[model samples]
Target: MASSAIKHGELVALQELDSSSPLFKQGASLRVTGKLQEYCVGTAIATIVDGSVSLKIDTQHLRDLNFRVGSIYQFIGELLIQSDTDAVLQARVGRNVDGIDLNLYHQSMHLQRQFEVDYMRTRTT
Candidate 1:
């Protein structure tokens, strides 16, 4: 059989990861949105924050992309968890999303999860 194709990134909130939530698999591809808190050019690392949750992102592979602090951005990457309180994203793609309503997005994500759970339960019944 042919090898399975790569999966699309899963949309997630920083809070879910920072809180050490068991909602996603380790090293899973993720799509997260947050405001750029800071960036270290020398280290090629950037910090993005949503609410009280913050995550460090490795930007070494994204040298072509310019990151501006305080700007809202969405990133698709692989999640790397070193510990309960430490996690990093190896960014593969990024883009600005300054116009997005983060609160609404978060609420929708919660609803989506509920729907998925219900659908799965129905299927297994």
Candidate 2:
């Protein structure tokens, strides 16, 4: 039987959207944080950057949220990758995350993934 439980957004970095990452699955729910680089009010589109990676965000569903360029924000949404250089996040929710330490967050993200892998290896063995 198919589970009816709602799937929660998985935390992901923009860099993880590359071809090698498991989180590159289509329609996958994801939670990402980055600095807002630009926003087009007419088209309801946003551009956010994390380190050297930048991603387009479709903000049609999140019209209520205010997006200010140069502010840090976190977005939870569905991922859509059309090509190697084209990836968009259909954002469902977003909020400002100013004052967040991105460097520490990146380190924690790496540690979390390492722990998950180690835990899975133990379970399988």
Candidate 3:
């Protein structure tokens, strides 16, 4: 039977994992539930890589949900934790499910940044 809560991993605060701890390491699977922050609601999934958070949301989802930053989200998956470097957590993602796609997030971020730059350049005399 499938349980609503994550059985293999432990429930932990996002902030706690965001902090420094020996518990954070490679092969470490953690379950974190917190308000969505930093990413838009369209972000159905997200992941941690090199100590950075990335979203795995799509354009259709973005328009449908219109997610805003600072919203809460739940994360559960494995981490490639490393000392002296940021840990990367691969989140399981799906519609109404938990997970993250790093590649998608990077592409979105790049496009967004490019658009911003283009806008700024065009506005400049």
* Top candidate (lDDT): 2
Deviation (Å) of 87 in candidate 1: 1.5
lDDT of 1 at 74: 90
Candidate 1 per-residue lDDT over residues 68-125, each given as its tens digit = 8999989898888777667788888888888899999999999999999999999999
| Candidate order (TM-score) | 2, 1, 3
lDDT of 2 by residue, 42-111 (tens): 9988999998998888999885688889999998888898886577889888899999999899899999
**TM-score: model 1 vs. ground truth:** 0.84
Cα displacement (angstroms), candidate 3, residue 4, comes to 21
Clashing pairs in 2: none
Q: Flag the better candidate by lDDT, 1 or 2.
A: 2
Please list all clashing residue pairs in model 1, or write none if there are none: none
lDDT for each of the candidates? Answer: 0.85, 0.88, 0.47
Q: Candidate 3's residue-wise lDDT over 1-125, tens digit each? A: 97565436554444446436655666666655433444433444443222243422222222234334444444556666545455655565212223545345446656876998999999995
